[model samples]
Target: MGYSVVKMKIGNSLEEDIRRIEAALEVVPSGKNLAVDANGRLDLETAIEYAKALEKYDLFWYEEAGDPLDFEIQAELAKHYKNPMATGENLFSMQDVRNLIRYGGMRKDIDYLQFDCALSYGLVEYLRTLKMLEEYGWSSRRCIPHGGHQMSLNIAAGLKLGGNESYPGIFEPFGGFADNIAVVDGYVGLPDIPGVGFETKAELMKVLRSVAE
Candidate 1:
């Protein structure tokens, strides 16, 4: 319902997912400070079993426990599910999201939407598609990004949308090339520092200049 303070995954077993879900339920007070995302990596049956296992807990959203572009599979998965399912990772275009909606998942079980700016049609293009998501009865703000983790983080910091994924390890390694944001405590906040807030390898640059010279 609202932004969750803690998020998690099943770690790789139905039994584990069930136990974790129960523990999270005990802590999060029905519907706050907890959002669980599976990252789209389970079989259909496994997903269903996991979903059935945690009927009591109010999940903020169930992320892609399956295929990213397989709208057809997603369509069937979202059907008649009690908890809301979400998708949109490793997705490359607005068409991916549109197809997720057009197929059946979006309206049926796709409760939340996620996107990675690097993989999708870029942030600008994805932003345009955000408007389209609403036409299908979805919210752009609900779009918890997958890789735009930093961009989404900044947006979430402003309380703009649901929330953003904090792939600290993954994004930080890549952030050496550009700007990046981090999630502190439970909210996303940009660090104020020199040179986009990160140090650079002058030696690396000098090597390039030397090669050219």
Candidate 2:
């Protein structure tokens, strides 16, 4: 309930999605941002249409409206809309993310990068990707990483990234912060426990302890 940002899933029906988003906008107070994810499901034409329709909602970002690898589609959509664009969650390598920067029509002033460390061969490689961002003139602040795991949380803490994603109501035991921790005013304190801190979460700790022993 303390969340300042909300991301909704779309791409089901263009009209329905627009109405839904518009309805939400009516309830969301000013100063709060609402983002929407299409999960890379829309085709280019549909994506462009939705982009025009959704412009009025003033979304924080419209994410992955087409295939994750279709940088051209994303780029085209970007040209038609003023809202921020976000993608790269499915990209698993520095080169892939580099391509997004080079060809994805992402604007550093308003776009977001969502690279996931755990999905992309862990933090070692993710560090390289972060460095690549610097060469491309993108800041770590533009990157709100994709994975919702403790590993991403630790990395965000260590590297001072923009933020980490979370699925608080899904993927129990593995998709959220330490159980007792609350998202206070949209911020949560990281656990002091070492090495990704899974042990601090009761359900997650049960599995971790069982595997370690």
Candidate 3:
């Protein structure tokens, strides 16, 4: 299930991540989409070095090459890198997504457009984001929804995005509401169950929130 362009953090050093990547590669079979998210942890030079080191890994995209706002820098990185690039979750609006795609020097440097619409906006904003992307000629584009996992998958499938992102951080104990998610074969399959198809553990939230109150 490592296909469909999934990313995992490698932290500061490439040595360990390289080994980890090797181990993962063994089980990944072949022809699965894959990538990495550095979380902007490395300097440009370091990021470049690391990217080169993992060149054999053939990452699908690298996240946050630098700052999200620094389109110039990201574009520069993209120019040098072999794989595609993606970024979001730090941006606050659809305009940010548009600007990245329309970046002056690096317009369209972004291969995949990643954006998030929180639940507060409900379905309206979610649909709005989709409409906006379509209006901008991104109808054939791939967008990774930020806040809504299942919702994002639905949108991705409908819009024919590269694929939706997994909500849980790779190592987090809370494996998100959808544990059945798989990245294999370069595609995502939505659950057939009704609604979002995720069963939230009601008591789990209460247990965690008890310490807050």
Candidate 4:
């Protein structure tokens, strides 16, 4: 209930999505961030139209309007829209992410990078990606990794990342923060237990302990 940012999924139907987004906006209250994710499913024209229609909402950020790897379309969308845009969840390598920056037409001023640690060959590569971003003048605050798990939580705290995504009550035993950790003012403290702290999440640790034994 202390959440300040809400991200919704879109790119299904233009009319329905617009209606749904408007409905979400009505209840989101002012001063709160309302973001949306299209999951890179829309075509160029539809993505453009949706972006145009979405502009009036003052969204916190619009995410993955078209194919995740299609930088050309993103560049085109950037020309017509000025709102903050986010992508890179599907990009699995640092090289592709670099290409997105060099040629994807992403504006650092208002765009976000969602390079997940697990999805991109784990934390080692994620660290490399962050370093790459720094060379290009991007800050670690611009990143919010794609996965919601204990490992990412530890990494977020250890590296001072912008944030980690979360899916509350989903993926039992593997997709949440540490057990008993409170979400204070939209934030939760990481566990101090060793090795990603799986032991702190009771249900998850039961399964993990079995694997270890």
Judge candidate 2 against the unseen true structure and give its global Cα lDDT, from 0 to 1: 0.86
**Candidate 1: segments with Cα more than 4 A from true spot:** 1-4, 24-31, 108-110, 154-160, 168-186, 189-213
Q: Write the per-residue lDDT of candidate 1 for residues 1-213, one digit (tens) a residue.
A: 123355787638887777777777787767445667777777777777766665556676777777676676677776646776667766667776677778846653337776765566655776666767767777556776665334445544443566666543353433322233334455545655443322342444456577789
Top candidate, metric lDDT: 2
User: Over 4 Å off in model 3, which ranges?
Assistant: 1-6, 30-32, 104-110, 119-122, 146-148, 155-160, 167-195, 198-213
In order, the Cα lDDT scores of the candidates are: 0.61, 0.86, 0.60, 0.84
Cα-based lDDT at residue 40, candidate 3 = 63
Cα TM-score per model: 0.70, 0.95, 0.68, 0.94
Against the true structure, candidate 1 has what lDDT?
Answer: 0.61
Q: Rank the candidates by lDDT, best first.
A: 2, 4, 1, 3
Better of 3 and 4 by TM-score: 4
Q: Candidate 4, which ten residues in sequence have the lowest lDDT sum?
A: 24-33
